[model samples]
Target chain A: MRFAATVEVQLRPGIADPEGATIDKAIAALGIAGVSEVRAGRCFRFTVEAEDLASAEEVADSLGERLLSNPVIERHLTTIEALG
Target chain B: MSMRVAVVTFPGTNCEHDAIQGLEAVGAEAVFWWHTETSLDGIDAVVLPGGFAHGDYLRPGAIARFSPVMAAVADFAAQGGPVVGICNGFQVLTEAGLLPGALQKNAQLTFACQPCGLEVAQTSSVLTRGLEIGQHLEIPINHFSGSYVCDEATLASLEANDQVVLRYRQNPNGSVANIAGICNVAGNVVGLMPHPERAISPLLGSSDGLHLLGSLVSSLPAHR
Candidate 1:
């Protein structure tokens, strides 16, 4: 089976989100109202081959830590969906 | 009378030449080593110069850490051979798990390029042995993601072990604890954001980097 996985990575809260802050300022400059905040992160989408959804999730979880996101600064969440 | 230093060059690396010239000016024979080569033969020291290795695809140093030469570099570091990573090289070292912490976007959210003040926080590492603790240095920093970050526990450990080598006198990049550089527990590996090779010549603005590079040379094993 093939699982389509999306790994979302973001800097931990309390860490300075300079890029996000910059974007927030830019948005404010555009006269957009009610925009309370903005934060920046990256999303990695890939397909993993495994026997089942559990196995695919397991593989992605390990890869998310080792290669997708650095645990030192970024936290990651993984979502896996089986593909036909 | 001279040490052999290998400056590893990844595809996008642009500072190896400066590193080579700087090391040679300081009485070390520096050579360029391609990232594909997995050998450190006759090398007394290794340098990872600044650059966008592997186009910094995943993150600075993330992709480059898997390069073939990195294994050899890791082994060299394990054997107590001095290894220093400058700028992007520093990022790679952290990504490779050779050093603690990680480099994030500068707190100012801009690419900073200017001379910054540094304080020697440690004197026992291969990268700073020539200097006394609390010494001041003016070195150039040129990077967007140079902010050093680590967990509280790791920061405490870094301090307890004296692994923190350099601290920004003014904290230019919002690094936790003002950490500008750090060494591994073994003291042979060091990673920092400032471009020491760029500070070797007085004409280039300052000669403070010579003292740092000189420390690496002097820390080498006898008869190298």
Candidate 2:
């Protein structure tokens, strides 16, 4: 069985986060950053034990699209780890 | 030579008539504009009244901001036309990025509907013209996502620019800084959580709202 959840990152509307910009500036100063700007967002981790990885991924993907994240303002990433 | 105003109605909007009535009460010749219609030609000002547009789905105002009528609203606003958004209309303005900060779910986790007192925070806005600064008025609020949230810097800039138009006398919805109403930097557009249309008559138990509506008539065009 596998359990997995998705995480998302997006800036809260109307809030100016200088911290995210400063971090990007530091990364660019090192000449190692490809992104010009960064906005910190949020992640949601939930458990969905399934019979297999494929099933878990399917559940996670749908959940990500339908419930966990707003597609209009959110970007999502998912990973699966076995639960003890 | 009548001052012509237009009230926009989205799919689920229930308060267009109320808005029209309120505007008409103040002597403006008010009419309705459909969300499908993109242009508000011949109108001196525009009002986006409250009610659940699209049943408050996909986040309040998120979907309605891009409606065809909003194009005209945006253009009119850029031209410095007075645009007022009451309740859900306020949500639409914030979602459209015409105003700063977003209204979040009330911290108490309840949908509040009652009379709330507000202090005039900015009188320079066309929506607040002829009003004295720091004056108090009672308006009715009805919503779940009436809580206002903004980052410290943006909040500070708004304060510095005098964009806050109204503040609640008593914090009712856990809003940041007790903000109940705010205007854009230009002060032509204002978004407020309370419903002025719900408060504009002596029969309604408080006529303090008339002062704000009367403010709209300040230098407005004659009736259509």
Candidate 3:
């Protein structure tokens, strides 16, 4: 079976987000009021060949831990879906 | 025989030449080692120079940390071989888990490149062996992701262990506690954002970096 995986990595809460803050300032500069804030993160998409969706999720989780995201500062969320 | 310093070069590393020249200037024989090499035989010490390795993609140092040579670097460091990683090289060491903490984008979200003042915080690390605590040095830092961040527990441990070797006298990148450099518990491995190689000669601006790099050379085992 084939599965599509989406990995999202974001800086952990309490870590200062200078890039995000800059983007938020830009929005304010553009007169976009009522927008409280903005946070930035990365998204990775890939397809994995595995025996089943569960196994594919496991692979994605491992990849997320080992490569895609740094456990020290970033948190990774992985989602897997069956590919028809 | 002179000390053999392997200046590891990743695909996008642009500072290997500077590292070699600077090391040679300090009387150590330096050679360029490709990132793909798995071992560092006959190498007395290692210097991972600055520059945008792997083009700084997927975050700085993230990709280069996985290079084949990094395993050898980890092994070399484990056995107490001195290793000093500068600027982008520092990022690689942290990403490779050889050092603690992480470097983030400068708090201003702008690239910072200029000579800055640093205070020696520790005197026993391989990179500061010849320097006295509180001694000041001017070193240049060039990077966008040079702001250092780490957990509070890690910071406490580093302080207690005397692992924080350098602190910015005037913080340029909003680094927590103005930490400009640090080392592992063993003191053999050090990672810092400043460019010691670029500051080695008087004609190249400030020569204060030589003091730090010189300390590294002095820490090496005389026979090795």
- Give each candidate's interface RMSD in Å: 0.7, 9.9, 0.8
Best by TM-score: 3
- Runs in model 3 lying further than 4 Å from the true structure: B222-224
Off by over 4 Å in 2: A1-84, B221-224
- Candidate 1: tens digits of C-alpha lDDT, residues A25-80: 98989999889668899999999999999999999988889998999889999999
Candidates 1 and 2 compared by DockQ, better number? 1
Query: What lDDT score goes with residue B206 in model 3?
Result: 90
By TM-score rank, best first, the candidates go: 3, 1, 2
Give all TM-scores, in the order shown: 0.96, 0.75, 0.97
Docking class of 3: high
Looking at model 2, residue B8 earns an lDDT score of 88
Worst 10 residues of 2 chain B by lDDT: B215-224
Evaluating just chain A, the predictions reach TM-scores of: 0.95, 0.59, 0.95
True contacts kept of 2: 0.00
Number of the predicted model whose DockQ against the real structure is largest: 1
lDDT (Cα, tens digit) per residue for candidate 1, span B183-219: 9998999999998899998899999999998888878
Worst 10 residues of 3 chain B by lDDT: B215-224
Per-residue lDDT of candidate 3, residues B47-162 (tens digit)? 99999999999988999998999999999998899999999999999999999999998998989999999999998888999999999998899999999999999999999999
